[model samples]
Target chain A: MASTTLQGLPASPGIAVGRCWTVDRRRLRTPRRKVTEQEVETELDRLDVAIDLSVQQLDGVRAKFQASDGAEHLAIIDVHRAMLRDPSLVDEVRRLVRVERVNVEWAVKRAVRKIKGAFDADDEFFRERRSDVDYVGERIVKNLMGQGSDAAEMPPPGSIVVARDLSPADTALFFHDRRVAALVTDAGGVTSHTAIVARALEIPAVVGTGKASTSAERGDWLVVDGSHGLVVLNPSAAERAEYEAARVRQMEREAELTRLKDLPAETVDGVRLRMVGNIEFGEEVPGLLSHGGEGVGLYRTEFLFMGRSELPTEEDHYRDYRALLDAMGGRPVTVRTFDLGGDKLPSGQKDHSENPALGLRAVRYCLRHPDLFYAQLRAAVRAAAHGNLRIMFPMVSGVAEVRAAKWALAEAFEQVVAQGLPARMPPVGVMVELPSAAVVADRIAREVDFLSIGTNDLIQYAIGVDRQNMDVAYLYRPLHLAVLRMLKSVAEAARAAGISVSMCGEMAGEPLYTLVLLGLGLDELSMNGPSIPEVKRVIRGASAREGRELLDRILDLNTADDIEREVRAEMARRFPGLLEGGARVGPVSG
Target chain B: MGRLERSFVIVNSLGLHARPAAMVVQASNRFRCEIQFEKDGLQINAKSIMGVLTLAAARGASVLVICEGDDAEQAMAAIGKVFESGFGER
Candidate 1:
């Protein structure tokens, strides 16, 4: 067979080479024979047995994952279990079986279609639920047809599972043992249940690859480059060897990073920088600490307010912060107040402004809603007494917002004290994200104990380009001359005020910009847990003087492209093959 | 002795998604009462996950919850707490 390659959506980040094992999910044929009145009871009994089996199977899946970190994905299985016994669906199926006098299989098919009709909205969430209904219906129907037994043999370890699409149940059953090396599906976007579970399990997966299931046969040799969303079928010898080498290198790199888990992120010279993690959930604390995270730089508290009907109360805030502090075991945890508004408004609050990003959000939104802000402020001060805690305000425009936020914190502190509650004023800081904030960083620094530059928004606002908009996305460069200048100035201002400055942004994690950031004199780099080792590796190899020289050289560059090229060339010359795999693409272009 | 009625605003973002819908159904099934959710003039049995899901309530949407039977008050109280907590999500 000729070698062929298929491009797909990168659902997970890794590469795997293995023989393909195709999961056959052909649509079952429903026997639709009319039944006599006396036969209706028998049909109803069959439906009951099927629902019981389906629920049992889902429970099995849930029990298998209960001890693992895939707790979030387990909720989907529970939902499926509830749907299995849902009165609306069960009653509808039973009605068709009794009144329509049809076979249980056909009745299930009809009931499923009826249920799907109720979910025929154009919304993505509904679309997902519609598929869930279909999967549940199929499970019961399959059982009724005497096909509920465990049929397909498990694929051997390190086999790539290819399928047209996988139900959440199917994904849970097959991937539970962690035997399958990779996954490929002809359908599903990044947000699909299969994609989400694949990422959580850290399995290499390529999804939305049209015709992958049809093209690849069982036991066919395949290479799944999930990082690049490329799959090679019947790869030529050279192609196979290339991917195999890449896979080996990736594993080796991971092993090396794991070995650096205990090492400090200090340059060859004596200068040292704190490597921390920016996390939303306390559940992620163990993973962060394992990757050598010294502390929590940005504990995004806004997530506590998301997905719920009512605002989180002060006790809710206090409990969460205290737990996070205890998890860190006295390591600094900087909790940012609710940065609501714009795209992240709470339930029941709608943003009616013409331009939301530039409108009331972050500090502005919190100030306007003092009651909500005070709850968080009071929680932060109370949690400070338990462990190392710091409080930071986001999107501060300048000194006035800083002063206002500090005042609110003071009020909350006084109130807590008046109530005879445990409270301590945590060290405070402001996020220098807005251009106006960056311009007056000196004054803002004077009002706060430290400064953290949120480069993601700063670059977006400074460049005046929405990174999600493809046409303007190319202009969203981290090494842009303007962005670099702002960073340099912010760092200088923090230093002049005799305060520490950290960066908690996408740029802080990228190995390509480590030296430049080090040269800017950043005291800390807070990123996702996985990125800590690689960035720290770069920091450990280079000297601060060298970084300073590189920064000076890039500052003279005339364009973003030029600066990026210089940085890329410099990293390659220093680190050797560090930029070759995973998130990093190919070599720099002219 | 009589039916109980209450109005609620779906407060959770991603209003009444599958998890929350299941929560409402489970809570409603705890009492011996006929509970229904009415939104946009479409009423659905609160004890039925599918019926509750059919409401497709988005955040800020107003829903009229109706409970009636011998245990209507107990059923209303139990289901009201679920709605008030936003299904304990977010």
Candidate 2:
């Protein structure tokens, strides 16, 4: 057979070379037939028995997985269990059987379609729910037809499992034991339950391959390059050897990253920097800690305000912050207050401003809606009692905004104290994201406990380029002379103010810019968990003196291209085999 | 027999999504009561997850929960606690 290469979405990062284990999960066919009046009662009985059996099977699956590590995927099973007993579905099926005089399996199929119609909206969340409803319906139909539960067959260890589509249950069953070397599916996006489970299990997976299930047969040799979302079938011996070598290299890189986890992000010349993770939820804490995150530098609070119509209540804010603080276990967790009204706003609110990026957002939005802002502030102060919680206001354009935000925090602190609730005045900081804030960082630094440079926004605002615009994306260079100048000035201003300075941005995580950030005298660097070890490794090897000299050289450069080329060349010379891999480590933007 | 009705704002971040809907249904099923939910004039049986989900009551949307039966008071109290707890989510 000719070698066939399929491009797909990279669902998990790894590579596997093994024979395919094709899972032939054909869609269950629901036999549709009219039932006689005498058979109607029997059909209803059959429906009840089928629903009970389906619930029992889900319970069994849930019980089996409850004891396993990484049990986050088990929540899906609980939802499925609840859905099986849902009166809306069960009632609909019974009504269909009695009124339409159809067989139990046919009634279940129609009932599922009816229930799915409610979730037919073009929303990602609803789309996932629709799939859930379908799976539940399929399970009942299969049961009514006397087909056993859709438990997956155990594939031989080290086989790459290929499927047209696997329900969450099927994916859970296949990948539960961690024996499957890799997985390739014809259908499923990065957000699909299958993709999410595969990632949680850290298995090599390439999803949305379009035809991987049909193209590869059972026992066919396959190379699954999950990192690049490439699958090679019936590979030549040369290609197989090349992939095998790449797999080993990737394993070595992972091992090396794990080894660097416990080390501090300190320069060879004795300049120490705190390495932290930027996170949104408590669920990410374990992953962050595993990667040696000392603390959370940017705990974005905007997610609480998203996807919902109403503003999060004070209790909502309090619970979330308390959980995050407790998860960090006395390590500082910087919480950015709701940075809404620009691109992100609560549901039912629309941004009518022609240029929202420069419009009412962050501090401006908070100031305008004191009620909303107070709820979060009160929550922040109350949560500060539990652990080390630092409150930072985002998109502060000037010192006045910083002062106003501080006043609000003080009021919240007083209110909490007057009410006799546990509260503490968390250290407040300003996010120097706007160009205006960066320009007057000295003044803003004086009014805050610390300063965190949000380079993604600063770069966009300073360079006057919307990175999302394809034509202008190339101009969104982190090493632009203007961005470097702003960063240097901010670092100098924080030094002058006698306050700590940190950067929680894409630039902080990029290994290519590790030396440049070190040169800027940042006290902390916060990024995604996976990027922490690599950046720390880069920092541990380089000296602060060399970093300063590199910064000085780049500052003299004329353009972004010149600065990037100089930095790239310096990194290659200083750390051999660093810039060769073109892997993007963390998110390029928030 | 008791009849109780109360308005609740869906405060959870994800709104009355799948998990919350299940919670509502499970709570409604625990008592001998006829529970109905009304949102934007659309009334649905709170005992049905599908009915609760179809409401799609986003955060800030007001949902009127009505319980009527011999155990209406107990059912209302149980369901109210679930709503106030935000279904164990943000």
Candidate 3:
């Protein structure tokens, strides 16, 4: 066998080395037409029944998860319900079958396209996971008009889950059966349910593997290494052995991490570091807490933007946030007001610039959509009373944004009080993601109770290295002195303002950079839920004094190159592969 | 064809996500037949549990029902309604 690689947004959990089972969602067939007037009524009734069945189908899937997750999966299901209930669908079906006399499949397709057009124009997050909704809608419209059921045979669980894209319905089948590992799909974003679940399952998934199966046969040996997001087909014996060893090493490292699952973060030097996690959704709650996260450090509220056909309403935000807070008990959960823009914005946003990283997002989107923003603020305020909740604004670079967000938050608190809902003042914080924010962080820190140096964005914004571009992705380094300098400034500013500061970015998770960050006099460190234990253990090994000493040395370095060399030397002497894959930094900034 | 009676359980932990529900619905719609799901002695027209679930099918329970109509016999065979009854489901 030979070796090759395919890259895609990683999603979902578990690993499998099986034959590919691709579900071609695009090859959807519509319902049929009637030959007689008598048939027209019968067909309409049949179409209605079919559509009803399809809608009910979604309801059933939603019901399945309702026990474990109450009404969470209903976002997309509700949208399908809307499609089923849409009066226009009946009109369109009649027009196609009765007027155009097109086959049921064709008619259904046209009707679905018309409906999809509305959802497409809806918003950014909805645009991401709408295909699942559309697929369901297509099935309903087709059946209503008399198109027979389109059923794709699921390959055995031992088979690799291959698809153009997968919906949560497709993922649910793998609840306990772990054989379906390593998903390969032709389509999806990193945030897609399929992709998210893949990563959660720890499966080696290579999505956007466009026509990957064309490269080999069903029986031919292939290696799907989802960690590096690679797929090596027909590898030489040497390459196979090499990968086999690498896989074993990977598994051992994972096992080691799992051992720290219950251990508290205590340094040998008797320092206890705050080890928090990033929670994007409630499903992440168990995993995050299971990994020993003290609590949620950064909850990207932009997640509401994913799935379904419409924007999440105030009640939706309240319910979702409330549920998460309830799950966390007393653990502090920092809710980052949507930090979207760049490629992450809902596709519906207008005139989206190429450099969206430097464009309007987070507070900007909130400010523009005041009603939705205020509703979310109220939700957070209410949820705060349930647990140790903190409200944070993303993409803040100026004093005005902080003041404005705070003002809105105050109003939200007042409204919640008026509504007689339990409320608490969520500690207000800002993500120091932009250079402007970091540079003037001291003054900004004065306005807020806390600051989180988002070194991923800070480093990218400072060095002007696009972390995503593979060509320059190599240039994305964390230990760069400028970034350290910025961190120093934010830390100093927060200290001056008497406000605590934390970091919830990729760099915060790196053991080598941990000392440098601590050295800078940071108060808290939040990282990937999985890294919390070891990073905390590393912190325990060093006193705040030792970290401060390391910080002092790292601060004096002038170049990114020097910063990288010193970190590699120190960390190599300490731990290997600690700073390996983590962009030496985090997200590429402006 | 005589209406043949048979049962299938919903093996999936979640009885019917929208897609699967729709799949079962579509499957039932294909045969010139009538399908109903029965659980706890309460018969639910397989067509609508948007009623039966107001009855609540707990994860582990026995549910029995069958298909009736022109092609009810064939529809009863492939439909996994029996699986939904939690037949040995973990």
Candidate 4:
């Protein structure tokens, strides 16, 4: 058969040439028969039994996958478990059975529809949540129908999975089962929970294909090119040969990068550079180490505080920090104080502002709640005795905020000392994220031991563009002259103060920007663990002087397009295969 | 015991979504009270997932919780704690 190629969003990057395994999640047809008054009691019993069974099934799934998948995946199960035990759903189903005098399956279907209908269709989060509610309803309906809960079987190992859409629970199961090679979904965007989980699991995925499930048949030879977001079905002989060669080359490049794990991340000119990993959980330590990470540059401590009922006490913080520090084997771990607010607000913390991004968050939130901030500081201080630990505050606009935060940290230190706890004071630093922080970096640098430029927020704030908003995404340029100037100034400020400056943002991880960052005189680059080897390869290939020269030439450019063109051309010339997907340099532009 | 009521803003990033709704349900189940959560002009059984979800309370939305039973005060306090803690999602 002739080859047919489908285009979709590249949710993850890689090439998976495998047979197609289509997952058909057609909703089960419920018998909509009305029940007699006498049969109502029996139907109610069946509904209760179904709900109980679904909850048990979810618990079993959660238990089986909890050890392998970590908190994010387990959280999805937690949501499902919560949905199963949701009193509203339970009460509604019961009421529907009693009031509507319907079969258990019919009652479940109706109640799910009613609840889902209440959600605003315009809101994307609620829309996705509607699917989650439907997934739970289906589970209960299946149980009520006496059907096997495990009917959605795992695909054959290493087969490309084609589905209409995958719920978070299904994604977890597929991820833990390790049977699927790649995922092609008819629905979901890059920001969807499924896509996020796919990227976390390191699985190649092309989502929002809209027709992958219908176009591809079972056992068909499918090539899922996640980098280009192309799914080729029944590939021609020539196409297959080309893809096979590309796959081999990709594998060789990966192996070569892996071999550099134990080597120092020094440039060709012998300028020593530090490559650190940006992590959220302690479980990522092994992966980070395997990627040649010298230390943890950015350990986001917000995870410990989030998704829990109570604030993380000193002991809670200390335990987590201690475990992470122990796993790092004395490598420095810079723990950034809770960067909560914006999208990271804890439940029940209402963000009524029109613009949450620029609203009170991060250091501002901590400043308002000194008690909560001190608890975290105390934990970091107590855990410092375990290994090298550094505490940094996020969104510090000026020296006063830094001083205030340090004052709170000092109080925590005093409290720890009073208790005669084994506490050590780590170097406290400030993240130069906001434009105010960047403009006054010289002053902030003098007050802190180190400065880490969070370019993700820095660029957004400097350029006055919301990165998450697609309409203004074009304005979120990393190579923009304003951004380059901000980064250069921050680095220079840290240098003038004899303080170390590192970049722990999206810019640090991309090979396209590795040269620019090194050229700009950043002492360290901390990024996602998996991107370390490829970035290290680029660092090992060039000299700091060359990077500085490139930076100089690019800094003179007037527009982002010109800067991008020059950089991409230079990157392609220097490192051929590094800039995959043709001229596209990074995973996402800005 | 008398009817006890308290108002709390849904602070969790997801608001009165499934997980938080479930948490509210679990907290309310601890008491013998008939608990109801009122939000956006609609009131739901605080212990019911469907009821809470139907409220469609987004982040920053305020929910008024009422309980009437022998442990009404305790139930109100416990449920209030769930909202206060952002359902452990902060």
**TM-scores of all predicted structures:** 0.83, 0.89, 0.57, 0.68
lDDT of 2 by residue, B1-90 (tens): 988999988776667877687778888888988999999999999877778878988876889999999999999999999998877765
lDDT of 3 by residue, A1-590 (tens): 33565655445422334455555555554434445655656656666688778766666666655343323344445545654654455577678778766655566678767655544335333455247446656666556545534344555655666667666666655432466756777766665566655655556677666766566555455566664455566656666566566655556656756777666665565656678887676767777887788888888887676532345567667767777777888888899986776656653655358767666767887888787688789888988887788999988879998999999999999999999999999899999989999888878987998998787877788889988888988777777767777778888899888988898889888776776766777778888776676676567556677677767776678877877787667766665656665322211111
Query: Candidates' lDDT values, in order?
Result: 0.87, 0.86, 0.66, 0.83
Listed per prediction, chain B TM-scores read 0.96, 0.97, 0.63, 0.93
Off by over 4 Å in 4: A9-13, A73-78, A81-101, A149-155, A165-176, A188-200, A248-264, A268-271, A276-498, A502-522, A526-533, A542-576, A579-590, B2-16, B55-65, B72-90
> Cα deviation of A309 in candidate 1 (Å)?
10
Q: What is the C-alpha lDDT profile of model 4 across A313-370, one tens digit per residue?
A: 6766776787788889999999999998865676547788887888889999988887
Which of the two candidates, 1 or 2, achieves a greater TM-score against the reference?
Answer: 2
Model 2 Cα shift for residue A490 (angstroms): 3.1
**Which model scores highest in TM-score?**
2
Best by DockQ: 2
Query: Can you rank all candidates by TM-score, best first?
Result: 2, 1, 4, 3
Stretches of candidate 1 exceeding 4 Å from the true structure:
A278-292, A299-331, A337-388, A394-401, A419-422, A433-446, A455-498, A528-530, A548-569, A579-590, B1-15, B38-41, B58-65, B70-88
Off by over 4 Å in 3: A1-248, A306-311, A340-347, A351-361, A398-400, A460-478, A496-498, A530-537, A540-544, A577-590, B1-90
Minimum summed lDDT over a 10-residue window in model 2 chain A is located at A581-590
Quick one: RMSD of model 1? 4.6
